[model samples]
Target: MRPGHGGFITVKNTLLHCYCVCGKIEDAHHLFDEFPQRNDLISWNTLMGDYLHVSQPRVIVDLFKEMCIGGFEASVTTVLYLLSAIGELGSYLGGESVHGYCIKMGFSYNLHVVTALIYVYAKNGEIDLARWIFDGVAVKDVVLWNCLVGKYAKCGMVEEAVALLLGGGLVGELSPGEGESDVVVDPATSSLNLNKSAEESTPPKLSQP
Candidate 1:
């Protein structure tokens, strides 16, 4: 009897671990419900991590909502994974919602989670939001600082770009424009005034929305 109990417990634990890694949440939950005891933090986080891993990012957000509604307390690991999944989706709205959750849960101090928040905002074209997150990160690394500057520059914030560049963030490098090519132009095409000829040859087409 003792040998059978030990073997069963080991099998159960192994199955739970696999379920989390493989993102088989429904199966894991079913097994958990059938087991006599299965409410450990590890088990809970494993299930959440699997949900984040297996589902598309948007679906992962829904899973997080379900977990929150179910009154399951989240660990730092779980929140970090959730933030990363949100960033991966590149959805500003979803990231914002998760940010609210993080604030409410007092997870605002987690460095990894904060960095994920910044990356999510930047990827979603919300440089202002990303800067806000970066400001809160204590002793922000040079890489993180560059992310904010580069994001602003990419979004066409010229003055902001210059400011960041002056502050030691590497700004855009000077490169030759398309017009600076060294290849000799064909005589016929070169002699033709491209702008005037294009205008004379064809009128711009209008498309109905």
Candidate 2:
């Protein structure tokens, strides 16, 4: 805690973030390791995020465990990164543990977290659990809607996926027992192979401001 010590840490964190953004992950990691305050949450999160960006999910998971062992309480950003890594690794048990942590820590209601949960479950072939999580959200965003629908489609539940879109589930307006006749399905939608479409579609990113 010298004068301007916090500001110095901020500057270093900024540089680390810049290096990561510029795809210089090694440089970023080097800078992070050199930080006087390795306990800095921003630095930890930034480095972990860069690892995630590089598709080094195991690295991210390792860093997450280190961060936890260091007694740093995870923020939403931290959880998002960890969840994405777990999903990429196809660790159903890890995803479930994180889901429980989110609920315990009061992040389960966050739209981004919920979306990530859906993704992890779907990726692990737990589509039913994903759907259950989706149904619990009272408010929905386009990203969340796309996530669930895409997951269903990816799992070859074409009817469920199509019903979501056609029944206005995207807008949270789907009513129980709503018949397909109430809404018009576009010709393109009718012929589209939802599984293929889902395959080409990228899942929404879990971003924080």
Candidate 3:
């Protein structure tokens, strides 16, 4: 690698991300294609993430397939973006394949990854699988708890949702200030809303090797 080439790639990737954030999908793709280090996993993930942000989930799935064919190793960030896209598309099979891959890669236990998995399963109406995943996590955060409970409510399991809300010790857990505001439930409407934490939306910083 030539001196400053890595820096140049970093700058270009940043510009690509900015384009995506600004909703300039075409410009972002063009910038991504022009990169000399376009093969970098970070660049692929960034572009895919941007496509997902713009509601172009189909684009993300295609990009993911291309990235795999290019022999790029997916990081947790990549999996999260892919899972979100799959969830949007309601593709149970695709979610399952990604879930299997996460287990194979040892990423299934990661909190963010697990949360994404729960989302994909729940969105696909596989609430049982989502609950199983929630049960598998011994140490649960409010986000995880809220995810399952909210999914249950959304699935019309109001009784179970209320039970988990009142009997599952979530109220007690909130007293300690652990994601208290993230879980909101309305008994009258039997509606549950789980606000995503900042960490859930922000991709981890990438360090170029």
Candidate 4:
């Protein structure tokens, strides 16, 4: 169980992260609910984040509602993952809601947030919107390149996708096996669609969401 706000919460964070990465939602939720520190936005996000990776991303909708009711203001990171979860649901309404919030709050310009937005739009079949976002980015990174390329390839925009993939060579760091590169494996990918569960986990399940 979680104690008062000041003590051991950091330890809880470490274990909770492990639980999330290992697909132990039940244990993660148990520890999360038991924590008195649930009043904090970070605590809620940490738990909410774990729920986003699993197949049941809709869980985040209910949790976000609770977070709002609890008066925890949403941050750029919060909306980023929430958008990812919404994307997994193929729910444009939810995605638009988050996008509206991001724009209203001036988070639309944040690099990672926009990247996630592009992904959500692309995954939801809003390729035009995804391209719009991608085009607006003056200084693009490899992660965005992978996303746009993947989505374009997925959407059958082969020429454009191949062009973008090949264009990376000019950046000099890109190579044949892009996924093996450091930038390709950035933690921002977790912001895509993360939810942890015991069913998909190996031995010693940490959480049960």
Q: What would the per-residue lDDT of candidate 2 be over residues 1-209, giving only the tens digit for each residue? A: 23356577778777887897798999988877764354487788777767876788899889988888888877667777788789778899999999998889877766667777888888789989988887777666665677777777667898998887876545454433332110111111321122233223333333332
* Number of the candidate with higher TM-score, 1 or 2: 2
In candidate 2, residue 63 scores what lDDT?
A: 91
All candidates: TM-score: 0.58, 0.76, 0.78, 0.71
TM-score winner between 2 and 3, please give it. Answer: 3
Off by over 4 Å in 3: 1-6, 172-209
Summed over model 3, clashes come to 0
In the range 1-209, model 3's lDDT, one tens digit per residue, is 23256577777778888887687989989877764444587788778867866787888889989888888877776777788788878999999999999889877766777777887888788988987877777666677677777677777898887687786677655433322222211111111111233224342232232
How do all the candidates rank in terms of lDDT, highest first? 3, 2, 4, 1
Candidate 3 — which pairs collide? none
Instruction: Residues 28-134, candidate 4: write the lDDT tens digits.
Output: 88877775544466667777677765655788788888888877777765776677678778877677788888788777766667767777778788888878877
lDDT of 1 by residue, 1-209 (tens): 13246566556656766876676767876775575354444455455455555654555566566666766776555665566566666667877887887789766665545655666787788888777676556454444455565566667786985675576534444222311221111111321122232123322122222
Error of 3 at 88 (Å): 0.4
Among the numbered candidates, top TM-score falls to: 3
182 Cα displacement, candidate 1 (Å): 38
